[model samples]
Target: MTYCVGMKLDKGLVLMSDTRTNSGVDNISVFRKMFTWQVPGERIITLMTAGNLATTQAVISQLEERTKEPDERDNILLKTPTMFQVATEIGNLMRNIIGERQEANGVKGRGRFTASIIVAGQIKGMEPRLFMVYPEGNFIEASLDTPFFQIGETKYGRPIIIRGYDKQMSLEDGVKLLMVSFDSTLKANLSVGLPIDVQVIGRDEYEASHEHRISHDDSYFSAISAGWGDALKNAFHSLPDYSFYRGDD
Candidate 1:
């Protein structure tokens, strides 16, 4: 299990994914869930995956290979003229991989090889876009009203995003929001342990403007965790008392 979140903002895009995988409590391991592709000033793309590690890695490896091969093969990086097309290609690949695994496992297959991804990027002339691709090869885009998406162990952290997100928030504030979201998920779910990989792509810059591996010892993330918790508690206590309840008492 893992947690991956992507936000579409007025200024640009922000993405984060954890590096935890587990077969059981004793079989836990760390594997990065984020991947990126860039053509410097022309385009930049980032992917965060969740679900079966093997399937996700295979999908990423296949995309990377297409960009390197002289012979053109249909791939997210090559055949897609736009970010929308790139997402379609990725979705199709995910569905194909899932079907192949199910067939190989025969009657005992639990459909366990499924995976999902969040895709976001900017092309030379277009606005930055964000998408959540599901295991079924279909996806939904993030809009102004619904400005963010998450996969895997998402429920624990979703509330913070819902309450705090704004389309105009700066990249700095966006990163802070994601850090709080991850902190909440980490505290509540053992399956979503951390060492988070984060990347920020600013609009029209066509390269990753900021990227980092945030471990437990990272000072800024530690501060974010502590600060958000204290802020929430103070906010709760500062709220006015219920007058109806007071009269009843």
Candidate 2:
């Protein structure tokens, strides 16, 4: 399906998502899973999505529409005073969309219409925050105890992050950690193919300090992938040999 991660670091935030969607082995497509909204120096918001493409696209479209027609209704993204409020609004919208689709399709649509999102951003006068919104309109924020969140095909990549994430690390290191995580995921799962989208937001900047699209041929990613594999193999070999059979041998 997809792989999206949002990290809350001391400096700011780092977000990344893969762009591959597949209906079947023969039917595959690429659609960006990352979306961003900004008000220059005032605020910056980023959303990374997973699960049903239709549901996520509809949620984003509705949010954008509200921003354009603020006179007709409250533009939650623009009017919210804090990042917490922004997450609340997005959670409500996503829950409503999924509920409506399920109701329209009746029981036949049970599990087909669900989706989840990672919301990360900052508003003027506030610190950067990160959230993982569930399909049920509930969410959890990242804290010192858990400084990151990953959605969609998460298992294969989670260990790398758990072992490497450091809240005090620089954005550069954050990106490198994410690349290793993503590379591990890509090798194990075909559904998470890349052309990854990445964004780095610096504290107080209220704008993306760096944005990149990494394709399969990217030199740096290639090096990371190869280097990680070699390191893993070396570590496995360097472990002390088993002593259980030493007497028999």
Candidate 3:
């Protein structure tokens, strides 16, 4: 399992994903869930994945290879003229991978090669966009009504985003919000471990304005975790007490 989030803000986009993958309590491993392709000032595309490690890695590797080979055919990195097309190509790749794996392994259910991805980025002449690609190769884009998308072990981290998200928030604040969301997930779920990868792309820049890996020993993350916990507890105590009996009387 893993936890990844992509937020679309007026300033740009913020993405974060955990590196942990676990088959069971005793079979935990680290694998980066975030991948990016950047053409410096021309384009910057990012993807965060969840589900089968093999399938996700295979899809990403093929996308990278397609970019290097030249655009004789319509590949994700080369054929997509816009972010939407890129997402469509990725969805198709994911669907194909799932289909191939199912045929080869003869799995009993629809989960063997099941995976989802959150794609976000900008092109030279376009605005930043975000999409969530399902295992079926279908996708939905982020918009005014839905400015964020999450994949993986997402439930534990979702409320924080819902409560704090704002379209006009700065990229820096967005990063902080994601860290808090990740911290919440880490505390509640054993499958989602640390060493988070984060990328922040500024609007129209077509490149990452900030990118970093937050390992277990990162000082800022440590502070955020500790401080957020204390702050939450303090606020809980500060809230006015409910007196149902008095209100009823």
Winning model by lDDT: 2
Candidate 1 is scored at a TM of: 0.92
Ranking by TM-score: 3, 2, 1
lDDT of candidate 3 over 101-201, digit per residue (tens): 98888875676689999999998888999999999999999999899999988898999999999999999999999999999999999999989999999
In candidate 1, what residue range of length 10 has the lowest lDDT sum? Answer: 70-79
Give TM per candidate: 0.92, 0.92, 0.93
The per-residue C-alpha lDDT of model 2 at residue 234 equals 97
Candidate 3, residue 67: how far the Cα is off, in Å: 12
- Name the Cα RMSD for model 1: 2.6
The deviation in Å at residue 116 for candidate 3 is: 0.2
User: Which residue runs of candidate 3 sit more than 4 Å off their true CA positions?
Assistant: 66-75
RMSD of each: 2.6, 2.6, 2.4
Per-residue lDDT value at 34 in model 3: 90
lDDT per residue as tens, model 2, 15-98: 999999999867889999999989989999999999999999999988877556566764458777998988898999999999
Error of 2 at 81 (Å): 1.1
Q: What is the C-alpha lDDT of each candidate?
A: 0.89, 0.92, 0.91
Ranking by lDDT: 2, 3, 1
User: Candidate 1, 3: how far from true, in Å?
Assistant: 0.6
